[model samples]
Target: IELNAFVAYQREREAISDSAPARQLFNWCREAGLNARGLEHALLLRDRIGAVCRRLGLPWVEAEPAGNPEPVLRALTRGFFGQVSIFSSGLRG
Candidate 1:
C-alpha cells in the first residue's frame, strides 16, 4: 500500500493532514545518500485538464472551498498523521 498525505483542493477543497513521515522519508533518503530531490511531481487539473473539460462542454460541476485544516496541521507538526487519497484515474499513464 502507498501512503501519501497532502493538502489538495479541486472541485471542492480537499485538505489532507501532513504526512511528515513521507517528508522524513525524503530526508532519510537524502541522508542515506539517495539523489531523490526531483523524484516527485504533480499535475494541476485546471492547468492541464480544465481547458479540455471546458471545450468539450462537460458539466464541470464542483463544490466550494472545504477541507480539514486542524488535521492537516497536526499531521505536519507531527510525523505520522495525515489523510490518504487514492488515485483511481488512468490519466497519468
Candidate 2:
C-alpha cells in the first residue's frame, strides 16, 4: 500500500491532473484501500498533475480556451477527473 501510494503520488506530481500517470496513481490509491474520504492526498495529487500539465503546455479541455487543443490531454483530463470523482465517492461510502 505504501509503495502504491508513493507511486501514485509521484505520478500525479509529475503528470497532468487528467493524464495517464495521475489516473494510475488514483487507481493505485483505490486498489490499496485508501478511502475517498481521505482524498486530501488525492486532491493534492491532482493539483500537482494540473501544475505539471500547465508547465508542459498540455491543454485542459474544460479549462482551456476553445481552439485546436491537445486532444490527448483534453480526453485524459476528462477521464481522469471523472474516474477520480467516481472512485473517490466510492471510498467515501
Candidate 3:
C-alpha cells in the first residue's frame, strides 16, 4: 500500500514518469487482490489519498541497525529513477 502511495507521489509530482513505477504498481495491485479499476481510481486521487502517506511519513521499515538513513533513501531514489541529484545549493524537495 505504501509502495503504491509512493509511486503515486512520484508520478503526480512529475518527479518521474508514470511509465516507470506506475505500470508496475498496477500489476502489483491486481496481484494483491485489489480491483485494477478501483486501484487506479484511488491512485488518481493522489493529492487526497496518496499524499497522506507523505504527510504522515513514508511507509518504511528499518532493516539494518548500522545503516545510515540518508544513504538508504538515496539508494532507493536512484534505484527507482536511475539517477538522482542533490543540490548543494540548499534546495528542498
Candidate 4:
C-alpha cells in the first residue's frame, strides 16, 4: 500500500508516468484483497487524490519497520507538524 501510494504520488507530481506502475500496483492491490472496481476507481482518481494527499502533507508509511519507530515518527512528524500544537504553561496566571 505504501509503495503504491508513493508511486501514485510521484505520478501525480509528474516525477513518474501513469503507466509505469499500473500492472504492479493492480496485482499487488488485488493480492491484498482490493476489488477490481475499487482499484479502477482509485486509479481513475489517482492524480487528484495523490495531489490532495501531497498538498495536505499526509503520511504514507512507505517502508516496513523492523521494530524501529524512527521512520514512522519521521513520517508522522512531517505529515502532521502543521496540525499539531504544543503548549507549555504553568498553573498560575
Candidate 5:
C-alpha cells in the first residue's frame, strides 16, 4: 500500500512538474513508512529532487494531509500484513 501510494504520487508529480507544492507532497508520501534512518535517506532524496525541480522552475504537486492519519497508517498496515501473507503463504502447502 505504501508503495502504491508512492507510485500514485510519482505519476501525479510526473504529470505536473511546475508546482513546488506537488514535489513537497511527493516528499511527504515518500516519508510515509520510514524510520529515523529511513527518513533521513528520504529527506536527502526529497531535497535533491526538490532542488532540481526548483532550479528548473518546474511546477510540483503537493500532498494535502489526508484529513486524518488513518489512511496513511492503513497503507503501512497493509504493507506489513501483505509481507506476512507472502511469507506465511510460502510455508503452507
Candidate 6:
C-alpha cells in the first residue's frame, strides 16, 4: 500500500502495535520491484468503498476502528497472500 495511505490507516485505526504489517508489505513490494501506484490505488478504492457504504447505509464491517490490525492482516496474509495477485488480475481482466 501507499506508505502515506497505510500510515494514515494505521493512525486512524489507532494500530499502535509493533507488528507493522503495512511497513512489511511496502518493503516486500519494494524488494519485489512492484509499483506503489497499484497499492495506492487499492487503498484509495478501499476508502471509496467505505465512503459508498456509508452513503448507501450499508454495513461496512471491516471499517470498524481497532487498536491493532496485526492479527487480522497476518491471518489474511497467511491465507490469501499467494492468491491476491491472481484475484486482482482476474478482476482487472
Better of 3 and 6 by TM-score: 6
Ten contiguous residues with the weakest lDDT in model 3: 82-91
Q: Of the pair 1 and 3, which is ahead by TM-score?
A: 3
* C-alpha lDDT of residue 67 in model 3: 39
- Tell me the deviation in Å of residue 30 in model 1: 12
Evaluated with lDDT, which candidate comes out highest?
6
Candidate 4: give the clashing pairs: none
Q: Evaluate all candidate structures by whole-model CA lDDT and list the values in order.
A: 0.41, 0.63, 0.55, 0.56, 0.62, 0.64
Which 10-residue span in candidate 5 carries the lowest summed lDDT? Answer: 33-42
Q: Could you report the Cα RMSD, in angstroms, for every candidate shown?
A: 14.7, 15.2, 16.2, 10.5, 12.9, 10.8
- Where is model 6 poorest over a 10-residue stretch in terms of lDDT? 1-10
Task: List, residue by residue over 6-83, the lDDT tens digit for candidate 2.
Answer: 445455546645547546655765776765346656568668989999999997445344333475467679999999
- Evaluate candidate 4 by giving its C-alpha RMSD to the native, one decimal: 10.5
Per-residue lDDT for 15-75 in model 1, tens only?
Answer: 3235554566465546645433333332343445667887888866432234435554564
Model 1 error, position 5 (Å): 7.0
Encode model 6's per-residue lDDT on 1-93: one tens digit a residue.
224455554453354346886676566557656655675676788799899999999987642354357655675697796798888899997
Off by over 4 Å in 6: 1-28, 63-93
lDDT (10s digit) by residue, model 3, range 51-76: 77778897645435543456557766
Off by over 4 Å in 3: 1-19, 45-93
Model 2 TM-score (2 dp): 0.28
The candidate that wins on TM-score is: 6
Q: 1 or 5, which is superior by TM-score?
A: 5
TM-score-better candidate, 3 vs 4 = 3
Q: Candidate 4: minimum summed lDDT over ten consecutive residues — where?
A: 84-93
